[model samples]
Target: MARFAISDLHGCRQTFLAALDTIGLNKDDELFLLGDYIDRGPDSKGVIDTIWELERDGYRVQCLKGNHEQMCLDGTKDPNWLPIWLKNGGRETMGSFGDHMPDEQHLQWMEALPHYLETPGYILTHAGLNFRRANPMEDQDAMLWIRRWSQEVDRDWLNGRIIVHGHTPRTLSEIKENLAYLNHLPVMNIDAGCCYDLPGRGNLCVFHLDDQRVTFMPNRDR
Candidate 1:
């Protein structure tokens, strides 16, 4: 059995499907989805529905919560978050829902999603932790929305576990260039801006853990 992870799917259902097809996901293989499943792209509902179908078919899929999802939850609680969410592509997500409204079951699932997941070799999260904090894991806000990190962060902050995260859009070249010795720890960012229609972006990426192989599916729009 193989293990794989993908991030920043947004709502590009076709691109996501193509990535799955490229990866040849089977019952034996496990898939970790690192959130942003909705927003910024077309067919947010389709993305959620496909995930539910995959689970129904007995695929081992682990879904994580993303900042966009946090925004979604916040929008439900406070009227103030709606405008911010809408400006940041929440309108596309709502449009995908059409007249049915956001699914309650999905929202509940999103609410229960863990902020981070630990594995033998890596720490998985929607966004990277605040290395500057004494206990980075305790800073919930940084785990969901942090875009930049300092070079002076504690190198041993994670005790040797590399952080694998999304939420920031960086091309493969950019990721490689930026993987410098940051406080002696390394971070791997896999969000290739799958929802974007611009150059140097808009590719769904999947990383095969055991083999350390990366596969990509170009966005349907491109």
Candidate 2:
């Protein structure tokens, strides 16, 4: 069975599904979603529904928590975070639900999502780790919101396993240029800016862990 990872879906359900189809994902194959499943695009509710259905049908899925998901969860607990969340595409997610907000099940699912996952060959997370920290596991904020700090590190910090994460969206060329492979440690970014509808942006990316293959599905909204 193949192992794959995709990230920064941003409510683009059609693109997400089409990318899976392109990868020929089957029941036995594993899919690791690096998060940002909601907001910015047209069908946040549909995206969540599809993922739940996939899991119920026995599809293997590991969905990580993204910064956007944190914003959504925080908005539910604190009134002050509502406006900030809305300003960053949470309004579109709310609109996708029509009259009501996220149900209890959805909230719980988002709340319980783990910050990171580690396997023999790869480290999976929503955002890259804070390499400067003594223990990145303690830095939830960096895991969800980090950008340049993780990308610019000159030395390999993962020992040998590569880091596969999303959060900072880059064009295909930019990602290729920035992808690091030094001392057997690689840092791969696959966000693709799917929410941004501009030329180089707005494309969903899927990376196959076993074969190191990268594939793309253009955004439907674009």
Candidate 3:
């Protein structure tokens, strides 16, 4: 059994699935999804549906909450957040559903998702932690929304475990460069911007946790 992680689906269902196939995931292998399953590209509802399907099929798929997921949940609860969510590509998400809204099951699933996860060798969160905080792990909001705080990572707090996250989209080259310097910088961003179709973007990334392998699947949801 192996462990794999992918992040920032951003509604690119085909690319997400293709990445999974590229990884050759199996039931015994654990799949950690670093969230942003909705918004931006296309088929947000379908992406969530595929996650549920994988769980039902006995795949060990664990999903963390992303900023987009938080925005989606807040948008449903408050009117003010609705426009912000839509402006940030939530409109595309709504269009993915025939009814232009998420169903109860999907909403509840998103609502119940944990913001962060910790294991022996890795700290998994949608976004990086706020190292300035005394206990970065305790800052749930930072886990969902913080950006550009990687430089502040509290190395002593992390000891030797690497931090794996996806929120701030970076080019494929930048993502690979990060892995090369993993010995010095313990944080890695695997988001290749599945929602972005621009240069150096649009590839969905799969990070093999056990052996530290990276696979890039080109965006196909265009």
TM-score of 3: 0.98
Best by lDDT: 3
Worst 10 residues of 3 by lDDT: 96-105
Q: Model 3 off-target regions past 4 Å?
A: none
lDDT on C-alpha atoms for all candidate structures? 0.81, 0.85, 0.91
lDDT of 2 by residue, 1-222 (tens): 989999989999888888888888899999999888988998888899999999999999989999999999999999999889999999889988994678888889989999998877888999888877877767888889998775554454566777889998899777656454433447888889988967798888888888786887888764
lDDT of 3 by residue, 38-91 (tens): 999889999999999999999999999999989999999999999999999899
True-vs-predicted CA distance for residue 3, candidate 2, Å: 0.8
- Consecutive 10-residue window with the lowest summed lDDT within model 2: 176-185
TM-scores of the models, in the given order? 0.91, 0.93, 0.98
Q: Could you say which candidate leads in TM-score?
A: 3
Ranking by TM-score: 3, 2, 1
Model 2 reaches what TM-score against the true structure? 0.93
Q: List candidate 1 segments past 4 Å from native.
A: 150-153, 176-185
